[model samples]
Target: MALRPLHPSTTPLFVAIFFLSFGALLFQFVQTRMFSAMLDYHLTFLVVSGALLGVAGGGTAAAVMDVRARRPSSAQLSIAGAVATIVALAIETRIDPVSSGMFVAAGVAYVLGVIPVLCVSWVIVRALREAPEKSGLLYASDLAGAATGGVLGYLSIGTLGGQGLYGVVAGTALLGAAALLVPRPSRVPLRVGLLVVAIATTAVLSIWGETLAPPRPGPFKSDTMGVPHEFARWDPLARIDVARIGDLGDPGHYAFLIGQGYAGPRPPALMMTLDMGAFTPIVMHATDADLAVFDASVLAAPYAVAPRDSVLIVGPGGGIDVLNALRQGVKSVTAVEVNRTEVALMRGPYSEYSGGLYLDPRVHIFEDEARSFVRRSPELYDVLAITVVDSFAALTAGAYALTENYLYTEEAMLDYLGHLTPDGVIAITRWYRDPPAEIARTVGIADGALRRLGNDHPERSIAVLKHGLLGLVLTRNGPFTSLDMQRLRTFADQRGFSIALDPLAPGGQLVDLASAEAPPTDDKPFFFDSVAVSDILAGRAQLPYGYAVLLTTLVLSLTMATVFVLIPVYRGARRAAGNALPPGTVVALALGIGFIAAELVLLQRLTLYLGQPALALSIGLAALLGGAAAGSAVSPRVPLGLRSSAVASAVVLLLVLGGVPLVTSATLAAPLEARVVIAALAALIVGIPLGTIFPRLVAIVGQPALVSWVWAVNGTASVVGATVGTIIALVGGFTLLGLVAVVCYAVAAMFAPQPRT
Candidate 1:
């Protein structure tokens, strides 16, 4: 039998489906941003995993439930989901994760977070089941809404904050509910009431939500716990909080130490923190004497070697490094910072309080990622300084162990070196750990950069200095002179600091890269990850915090899938005798695993190229889903079988893997606008083929019962595939992850059912 055309009566249903998907995705993005600020950064991944698991649970329930029987309308479910979303946000936002214990708090968040997603999934599934003939239309509506949601989600974070976004999501859901009742004249009054309430609630939340439920820092965060913050701002990159150290009413009580153990004068300053941990100070009422305090700190070791005419300060938070350069008598200084919210705060709100540091005539500021700015810079500098730039919360929790840090990659070092004068030095400071993995990685990166520059002896171009938990690595384009080494040793000795590496001195270079540790490349930029699987298995190193969380998620996902999806579907299929396993089940499962794994790889790869994680995620997801929607719309005309779709997908994945290095090298210095276009095009190319697979498989398994079972299988596989993709990237990088996706598609091709003529 031929499928029926989309009827005019179903227009309202499709529109409601669109809003449902839009609200669901917006809710997910808001949850990710909120939890990222409230808990350890790695927990953000859990948000994604939890949402997918909820999708699986809801999908399974829909498969088992009788949709033909009278049940609650889609409009009723949408409204319930809206209310549940608000309640979940309210509860999760107020709880102190540290006091409640990390696991307990996370468990609470995970359990409550699933309710809204499950509700959304239930509505979508029922819509699909009711209109199997219009499956393509419904799926297209779903993707289009999700694509729009992703782009708007990124844009709204800067304007709405997390709490405000929650309100927007609720309003969107209510609007969807109203749309569902558009065909019923008798429900006109209810529709009008819902619209009015949604608009009013959204308006109130957008105006005052931040004030009512302000984001609180975790106890482990470095910001002051009990005191009220002077200023706070939120954006996609991070949350910036400013706190007055002492009595705000009395200027006499305001004092700042250059660093711990420093005997210099305590200047008046205000504390500025990023993500509640990476702290810097804004100097208030400072004089020449106050500016000179930086000269006494270990961070000034690079400037001590020789007089610098010009300086480049990367991650110059609170303008501390810029002030240090000025105190060293540099003629010009360029400060590049990634977070625009922090820059706005310093330039607009705290200008007078900081003595107009950013307004200085000799100082120039650029709001850009460190590596991207350096790669496109037109001038060379006498010194490049990066001082304790990354967030301490992320570092200590090992949250970034699986994430990319282009700033610490060998390619980034090469970019820095390329933008430095012959005598200029690159200075990087990090918290020193007992095992010194960070220090070793820093040295290895510098060494790799120097070797790539054709240096015969890279060691002569690098030096390391340590003072209390702070370690600084200095490297230059050219070798450090004997006189320069002598000056560094003299400075370290007088300050009671230790020289971990000095080319001219004997027994130098105490920090060596372990044989298993490799210098990070842009392809495998995991600078914080030093523990290998062998080490973990041999009892040489314990599992990192981030990995442990990932394992727990995987276990939970498996358990949920087995209980709610697999067992119920198995029993139902067994009752049907010969139809125990659906013909397209394997293909659906493989598509889910392959599609998500590929998406993750694209997201990670494009983040550095686009210069911001949020931008990359928004553009990548939108382009991919949009392309998939287009593919689904045109699937009927394509003269291809399921086997052809899988083969084509595998070929595209291979092309993408091979093209990554080339694309990155060519676009490393391109304008952001141009890079964004290229990245979108790349993702769209991959999504077109992937989108064709599922709709074609649905046509083969025409029975509603089997179709729902296959949907559950696909959803379950997605829940597990997310964790599996992360592990693959953790072990063998994105290249291996992409290859695994290709293998999955190939396996799907082997199991694909024959097309009906």
Candidate 2:
């Protein structure tokens, strides 16, 4: 079987498929963002898993259909998909996830969301089946379209709100339908109608959808904070909302308190929230006397320990930490915040309300990830303050159990220590839970960091204080002097705080570091995952929301794949007597698992290096998919067989796994543009070889009946791989996940089918 060139007459089909692919992927991306705003951050991955399941279902359905009978036109299916997308978006906004419960709401959302994807996939699968000779060109177009969609979707969400972006995706699908009409002059009325509908719908949604069905925070968040926001903005990072809590002139209404113990006259303030949960106050019109309230809190211990001249604040939300530092008479305060939207609000709109806090000449602000900024900075600080950082809902509900948090790792502690003056201290604050898991972990991390820095008795260099539900840990490079200890005791006693850990004082070590859990590292940065899987399985500890949701998704996906895809495909193959399952089937499944597992691992690994999760996702997906497109396009010209391609891909994946840490570390200080380019190149190196394997496997299979089955199996494998890969990463770290991916590709190489001569 020789490769065949695509005919000029198929141009309309090719263009239609491209637009359809673009619209589908863009819709998925926007949906993920919407879910992040509407639900919790950890649940966003469900959208990806849902899309994969839908694709597999569609491919299997197409495979089992009678090829000799008339099927729905590509144009008709495109229109249907567009309509489904809009309806799904509309329905999603009205559902309350909190009241319905996470599991029920997620199931409903997952079902509704997959309908549009299934329609789009059906159209693409039919086109491939109808033109098997053009599989290489068609697949290339598909990958290229998806890559373009991912990059553009990221940019679009920033400019257009989430609702506005949904309209664009629907309009893109309509445009794809219209493209198919180019070869059919008989469908003139259909073409005119589609153009009219596309333009009108896009205009209406872009202009008015925000008022009609704007994305809202979930019931869990909105119940406490109220439904309407004074100011709201959405970006790839997170949704930020500003609420005017009380009148700026009403001093009695705003009793500003610092930490838990401050009880003094304070200025009025506004509340700024992230994802409608983690909140900080924006104090309004405060004089020097009004700022004195900060000195009475447990957070003031670090400032009282020594005469601090300069300070660094990580996550200075609403400028609370900045105000505290200023109150302490610190000479310079540097604040690093990750959310650009939040930064804009502080410096642009709320600058007056904040009394020029962000605009102060003494206060310098950088919009960068905390760890990344610290890694690249050249200045040494007298005190590094990280107090009560992280989302309130996420922490309380254990939603960050599987999420990577680079800030609390031992490596992060080392980085913070390196940038501090010789006698400077690193101050950390976390909510003190029963059994004190977080506090214990914090102590363990500090102890590990000190030992790594060649300090033998870490207890001598560490101090901890507890006030109600809040606990603060202070770690110094050198041992705390007697004066420092006396100052800490005085501050704690004055504020009615208890010393949780101390060096010299008798019975000062309240939370023993000797029995603390193992410290988290950059390789396994799950600081919030205090409960082990074994504990949950043994019924000793309840399952966290994050893990519960992931497990539910996996179970549902597997069930759906088995019922809708695997059964039908198996039956159809059996009915076609001679059309037996080929060796390519195993190769297809392995490719699917290996490709997505490697991709998920790479995204996690790159998140810290790239400075944001959304940026890493966009860059990683686009680069890998774009490289795959190029590889698919050139597979016909390459002389390699399926086995050779699989072997080469396996080699590249292992090489990349070894090189990523080195590359990211060496280029930590590089410009954003340079780092983006380097990350893209790394993805491309692995993707090209991977891209060649699937198309070559398809070519070797030769039977059109088997091609759809192969595609279906690959999609199913991907659906499973997404959840399983995440589980592996959560337990064994990204290194183990990457190794498992290498093993998958190697297995595929052994099962690769020989091409017919």
Candidate 3:
């Protein structure tokens, strides 16, 4: 065998690390995603995610820059590394790493990214440059460590508390140190004997991170960036993964993830179903069979009058109310849900044999956002039950989702009375951390509206909610109510509800619907949407001083272009600098941008086309996630940078181009076609570029030192670009931004002159 160079080929090892780091990154992302979805203000997560990535990118770039320059010995780099590590530590100490907002979050992200990127890049470059013979081993080692972090991080949430972020930071830091201290025969170890000092600093910070987590209902705190869903706590015992659920006071607000993994059956506990929680939480608990036969099931339950009685249930997820109605022996149950993903999950799992029940004949699930469904559904019921909304916290999303429309809309009252037979009863429930005075006003208003409904139909609508409130409105239509203190005693005993609902204040009042037109659109009624959800991912979205997160995003996006595409392409172009793109890439980027544009356009159109924006977005997102997952799994096997990747990328582009018209298919699920198209586009975006980049990156990097160093710089550029992209979109909307993305890709493709093999 021939003698090897100082740093051996460790490409495999680096690949392994990339693979491993993905596990951790995936876990972290999943946790953040779930938390974002359940939060009251999801924009908060977006800010935080962007912040963290921004910092990580910057930090990686800085370190990589030092390594690429080959300016110092391992010793000098080590000293700088230690100092950067200390800077990171100092930053952490200066600010609590738990808040989520504009300035502070941006600062922390910037600091974290700059320091680490610099440090890690330095260490890896040093390792390869010094022990050229062991370059392969060097890559393998980095990959191993990253992989460990990735897998363990996600699977460890139940056990880890607020220490996960610290764990990542600490581990990354320690690895940098190890890389520095390795045999540097090529250069002397810098005489910066901060080893003991660094170790001491680490020990102190570890202790602080362990003890500094705030108390329950904490105004601010940290949690493990672990699991398929991040678990945050007001108290450790009351852990919930919701978006922006608190502003300190325990009674202010709340939101939580209700379902288990995949499409598993939701827990049907008494608290979950009729209590305050996600529809999945409530429906999964109450529903047993699929929707088709639910009418007969709920009516046959011990509490109903007759098997054929009518039943109405609002808010669809698992369609358990439909099942309950079927159990009750009702002839039919009209089920409605605001989110469409749940509907797709039900049908797919049942029909595709993915592990859910399918329909035979009895249940019909209507895919409509609850508000529009109420306005349009012509069906009426004997027992009207609403198991939606958690209005306990008005400052949170409850203000919008559980507004006057659900309570006092002219159409809602009429629909309730229209469906029920004589003496039909309507029941509803919600959790109240603090039943604001507005809630009492709501009760009175709903009564007044019911009286108006009774002025005509008069079957009466009774609303019952917990936290000590019961509303019994008597419409002149009939004697539907059956109670007082005596009935309360029996109902509470039988239903296992605490003695929290006592109907006394204004038993029957008149409502003024004309005056209560819509939920106030002022600051108070603002609910979380996609734009808002992005800012709250991991802890707070703060950054260290002197650094701007938006600046960082722009920096990283550009850096990514430079490191992975632009610079490398420029260098390649220098070899053939004036050469034009092969034309394939131009087509690819153009179509790619088109695909992204279509996703947003279709989402906007859903409200007008199908009367449901949330549902379309949900289905689209779910499918996109699925596509990305598949792409990630398939990429490596194809071998990075191969002509195969280029071909695959071309095919993906072609598919996106072809699929645009079919997005509005005339099938039973014309709505679903958009989702599938979105999924295909997402996979193409992630896979084509990724597969193409890595192979070329391996070639452009040339040596281990270059590989480590170049990655960081690119990362930094990407952060900057991303911020710029977000800003542009905010100013001009998705159409303009999408065009920009396409342009960027086109410019890159035109300039990147790859030589034929």
Candidate 4:
């Protein structure tokens, strides 16, 4: 059978779907950046959850419109989009919730940000409802538009900034509304009104974009420090803010920049914050002198026992560690930092004041994540130094809770060992949250890494301190020698540091190292995880904030499912007893829930491979969306029966999931360009199969009137599934969570509805 061209009446609907999807995705990308600017990158899950729920909300609105027999007016939706643009912009700039009392206001801003997404989604659903026969085509257009948004959003952040992005999204949404009004010439007044609104929004944003969207001092700084921000810059990775305090060219001011979290205050200086909304201060100081390196005291341990020939410093903020590496007379220094703005600030503005640490000929700066740099580098280093990379604010916010941090995992630790010379030492500096608990956690991580590397007597490979701060030193070739031990003791004594666990002594003031389990591993990688529900209830562990939000996501999703998917399907069942409604609805819901569960896990997994959440969003989404669009285009032409198509798709998806670990491991050390190619291929493999299921089901069901109902079921399931996937990963790890997806897909395949054509 030849592909049929869409009816004239449906072409506009298709275009509307495309632009609405484009706008929705663009809006979401903007929202994610805004939230991350205010908070941390870890809250990505929250923004995503909101977008999914907004789609469900839109479907519900469509269901209500269908029941009322009212036509969706494009002009109204465009106006709503315009208003939403203004509201979202205002909320992003104005909301400040640093204190506990203001959390309620922050929550409201988050919810309000989702409204524009809901409006755009509503437009798509209405367009789809207008021509259900073109569902596959419209869905394909939507996915394509989404793919464009992913790529464009990534590009725009580099040039447009947040304000420009807002204007672009608003303009795109207005164009969608205008296109819809093209069919109704008589609605001239409404169209004109929409046009006016669009133009006015653009003008207002263009004129006041700086004041409205400029990066400013966050609530934490304004509420506590009372110092004005010197400069503010935005990037996909983070929002960088610099504040000069106390004096000019003073090293004491340097204390404020890099010495935050240390147990003392020094001369006030320039402070740079990566996450403005951080629960704890994340600052970069100008100098290390008199800056009391309290938490980073462990950073000095490895140097005492090892030669300083070559050093690899991960997350080297404020260039203190780089200076330390150079001061030790290292021949070469490889400094890997994730944030580009921070590096630029150090090299450009603060170079002269801070003695041009980054400008040194020996320093080679790589703007890359720690794990990615470690995995990709083949050079052996004399010292592998990781500063206190853990963010307590991020931990409490649960940004890192659900996501995989290969940096702290067993695999990463072992990989770091691989990059070390014969006498190389791996030094890890960590903040002390609680005494025994943190110690046990850190020891567990280190022990796991050693055991995996076939080091039976892991105790000898470890050097520890029992102060309020801690550091661990591990040797790859062999355990620490007597000379190394003596050196460590001497260094600690000179630095006023206390020793905790020493393999030579066998006993110390610290708890036994054996009790420390290995930190998270690649297979069971969750740095901030719950040991058990009982432990949380018993106050042995604090419940991660991610799980708390997961609960909220579940409740909201189920509520929407009840209202939009379940209620309608039940009513349809009552009205048409022999219509195959039950099987079709079940299949639709299953696919929706199953795909989201898998997609969430895949996104998290890819984040480990890609390093940053922003990169993951850009690359992961592009691959998935582009591949799905290809699959959607091919579905109509495939000759296979519905059941065969379902089974084949599910099988392909399962195979892709099974081979991911192998593929990623092989490309782990490849260059960024090569890694991107591998990621795209992987995405295409999973996406082609995952994308085919929905359209195939739509063909089998063949119920035009029930399109919104099916969409509602699928959207609701996605909302629920995403949250469930995160919880599953938190409890059982990504491997088990993946199996759950495999089961759901297989079940959907087995129970698929056979068309009555």
Candidate 5:
């Protein structure tokens, strides 16, 4: 008997799939933000891992259901989406930030968060298997929706807020459910009523859900100290809080103001906390009248000699630096800040107290990451000041040892030097740490940059001051002038500030990276990323705080991926008719691991260029998926041999390796528009060949029953790759990971098996 196609109408299924893909990506974006707030930013890797695991589970579920006597309906998948939306909403509203019991919360999030992703994955896998010939087009549609979802996610942050965004996610899922249901001509009345209710419910929630949602906790709020903050705001980037203190207990403790997380030495006039323990003041500045107090002025020392024709302050939290520049009679100031919410707070509630410093005519503010802003700016500055902008939580987060810090690298220092005038000064301040490894790191990085600029004697061009916090000043052309020396001596004498290093002074070199005490570098970059290697060696009962927790998370994620992959494969092997372990399956697993590892490195590198994680993730994901779609769509038309595809992929890998430096340089030199163009083009170029292989493998497999199994294999392998890649990076940076990816692709290509025709 002649029957309709397995997936039914192309148009309706495509539309439903578009909605499914859109909703899934949107949910992922929201979840990432929410979870990062609850945990920390490093949870991003785990979030991706959880979502991938969901995809694998969905594929497995689809395979199991399809093999049954009665095939599961699309309506069931749609209903799952609806339920998932509700569960997500509940999770968002009910859960509080778990500072202590984080693992428990992470587990809960992982289990619940995977559901909706599983629903969409099941639907997508089923759709692909049903119409294998149209796999490329369907894949393209899925990716296109995902790409658009990234833009939507970025917009939702400001437009909807957190609660409102969840409502949007729920509404999007509901729309997908309706799309899936609408095509069922047999159930018009039920579908109509259901669709109407979903739409109405979504609208009500989207418009007013935030009002009903519970208030989120401020990250910096002290549990012991019941003092209410003057102002506070939370965003994806960070939780910022501002408070005023009036504990005039001692006259020596008379600082103008105190900020949480400020990391610097207490100025002479400012009787602030000198301990470099955990809590550091993020911002503190003297009043305009007290600007002349040298010992109390850490940042202001740079402008003592250099003419402040134009001043550029990176990481201007609370606009204190801008205020200092204005007070010092600087002609112009440009402040670059990364966090949007922080900038808004500084311009809003925090502005009034600072005398509207951010709104001042001479002050030009740009909400951009520090390195990115520095790279794109055309103007040269007499003084460049980098105040404390360290993420303490991230520093303490053990697993993020491999996490990229472009701002502290040798290349980054060179870029900063390139933007400075001939006699310009670069001032950097950090909380003093014992063993003084950070000092060594800074000096080494600056010296390297100077050496690149043809400066033979880098030490003579550097000066340092250590009172409570550490301060280092790097000069562009030569040693500090006579005026600079006089100003520094008077400043030190006025406030009990000891000069750590000066070419004219006693101390030879402030810090020596060549002295075996250097912390970490761009190549060996593990500033705050040391795992408890010695403890693991000594057989300690529990791992240290950060390493133990992160290692456990990694082990758990990898184990889960292994279990998810093996169970379905084992089941499928028992039931699968011809050659249970097919050549295509091997190809899928290998390609899956290789592609994701390569892609992860690409995304991290792009972050350095883009200067923000959100932007990097959005652009990198879009370009990668979009390119894959293009390759997949074209693969069927131009069928290449498996060996040829592998070779092409290797060639692309080589291209990526060769092109990274070019992209890095271009990003710094190019204008904003050009930088985006450069990044997008690079991502797309690398994605095409790798994308072509999987679709070809799928086509060659020739068995519909095994499609979902292959997908599960691919997805699970990807999870393993992503998880293991982090550890590898922790050991050997992103370069080694990229090399691993390249090798995986090459080996997979060599191991390519002939499909059973």
Candidate 6:
């Protein structure tokens, strides 16, 4: 049947594959680290372009082997693979910006794309020569190693980190070469001395690599990032990657039942992200509340008990809603929380630390998002107090935020309105900085829209909208007293703030736009309505890219795929029976990589627009994983005749999956932490199916021993596609990445054999 792998003499061929794989991978790790050392995470990608060039060179070598068919001996092929890998790395050193100067960065990346292809080609050639009868054995061996590399890297990198990762890469390669000399009955001993020298060289270089620096705490500081985070000055553009507790209050001491999520330290004031602004009389008299607590700090609440009734406070901190309600005299209070960070601090490390009022036994705390508890709980509040930042638009964008949708939407309004005692009123307060008449008009529209829910105003509710760009509205569906207004005015005056009813023209707020089923989608998304804001706050949205690079890439790709591949195929450069992928395939792969590079360039634009680099990274990582998973799974089952077709399907799927997220504002606004987790889980679910595809395909082509070889080729292709995908996202942007995936699949499809027996 098949015996190439069992022949034992091919051990050298396996060793060569090991050497090349490890060597090239080591080189890449070093390249990456050096860039980081330069304080540049972005530049290494261009260097990766150089790495891919090495891979591309391997592809060229593969074609050369196909032409030389059966002409090279196993030893000859092994020697060639090793020499080629060395040559590729040496060449990379000259062009890689990490080692070379920065002037040729982009050009170097473009040129480097040719190297890895070449190295991969040489390894493939060696495997083929060693086991011509066992078609895919090289692939299995390589992938098995890949699995090992992944696990070891994961476990070790945490300890070793960036520079350490390079050390591992270098060590693995050097050790691999040493392992080759252990086998007997061949010239293994002759190479032992040389292998020792290589190991020594790697060691010496590791010491002088300059990429490595002395260990220090806050490890990212050691990298070449020119400026250590400790030394780095704060800029709004420089987002806070590391989370730290800004303030901690003990809940037992200062109990707060704010609708906003609970966040405070144990035994202190119980509160969340909202630290009280000067919204309360007690807080105004107190010192800490007046200072900007946590950038738009809303309030810190203290819990207390009243004699008879059970009380539910939404936002306990702002102006002491619970304390006032207690004075208004409530028996007990229940609070809801969403942002766990807020609740944990209040309930966790620093409870009772914030203030004196948190010790009340009448207060019951719930650390969950508001709507969720409300949806499940049968208990209704006698008075639901909603304390939020002002100016619906600005509020929606920042921490102290809420929207008109909650009050205006049919479902939301009904939910709160239904639960309200004929006298139970939900209170809301919004904030602003430099508000204008038009801004007031929008607020007026928001308030007017709420009247649809049977909201009644003692003072024609719109009366709360006032000057100073900051206003507070106290709207209710029930009759209330001037005494209540006096208490609110008293609280406001104590906090250096004043409020009066909003002045309206003709019919107040002057508008007809709020009646639509959903928020208006004009130049800017009009989604700050309470209901919509609630949906957003609760984490529901599509999470697609916006200002997508997709549109331009799509058009350019049509022109590109035509020019890069079609031209070659039309010239008969890709006859399946011939060697080297008809030259057109090679050109297409390179061009596809180029297009991907372009898309990566476009992603920067998105980052610039949204001012969120994390979003860009999320998009890039998702596409990378998705594409690798797809190719790995489908490559095996792909019929020789339908290869191109399957790849085409994959291309379209990636495009839809990755690029579509940019189009929907709802999706764009969704938290990436949740979205990315979901996508990664999806990719993981399909991993096994994809992983098994190659084994099955290799089995179809050759005996079990040969399957390993095929797996290697597949892994190599996947690595190529993944690296290229990231580049497209980084350089060309994600749109180009999708296009490249499409192109790769189409290339595979075009190579699909016409049906024949």
Give me the candidate number with maximum lDDT. Answer: 2
TM-score each candidate. 0.95, 0.95, 0.43, 0.89, 0.85, 0.42
Worst 10 residues of 2 by lDDT: 249-258
Per residue, candidate 6 scores C-alpha lDDT tens digits across 509-603 of 22232232332222112223222323444767321121111222233323432443233223223233243333223323433343343234333
The lDDT values for all models are 0.78, 0.79, 0.37, 0.67, 0.65, 0.38
Clash tally, candidates in order: 0, 0, 136, 14, 5, 139
Model 1, residue 719: distance off in Å is: 1.3
lDDT of 4 at 498: 62
Model 4 CA RMSD to the hidden true structure, in angstroms: 4.4
What RMSD does model 2 have?
2.8
Model 1 TM-score is: 0.95
Model 6 misses residue 156 by how many Å? 1.2
Off by over 4 Å in 5: 1-5, 69-72, 97-100, 182-287, 290-295, 304-307, 339-353, 376-378, 391-402, 467-477, 480-490, 500-527, 530-549, 574-580
Question: Candidate 4, which segments miss by more than 4 Å at Cα?
Answer: 1-9, 40-42, 67-70, 99-103, 183-210, 213-226, 249-269, 277-298, 393-400, 436-439, 466-476, 506-518, 537-540, 564-581
How much is the lDDT of residue 40 in candidate 1?
Answer: 58
**Model 6 alpha-carbon drift over 4 Å, by segment:** 1-8, 15-50, 61-121, 125-133, 178-751, 754-757
What is candidate 1's CA lDDT for residue 459?
82
1 versus 5: better lDDT goes to: 1
Stretches of model 1 off by over 4 angstroms after superposition = 1-8, 67-70, 248-262, 391-394, 506-510, 514-516, 574-577
Pairs of colliding residues, candidate 2: none
lDDT of 3 by residue, 519-609 (tens): 2221112111112223344534332211233344455445444554334333332333235432233333333333344334333333222
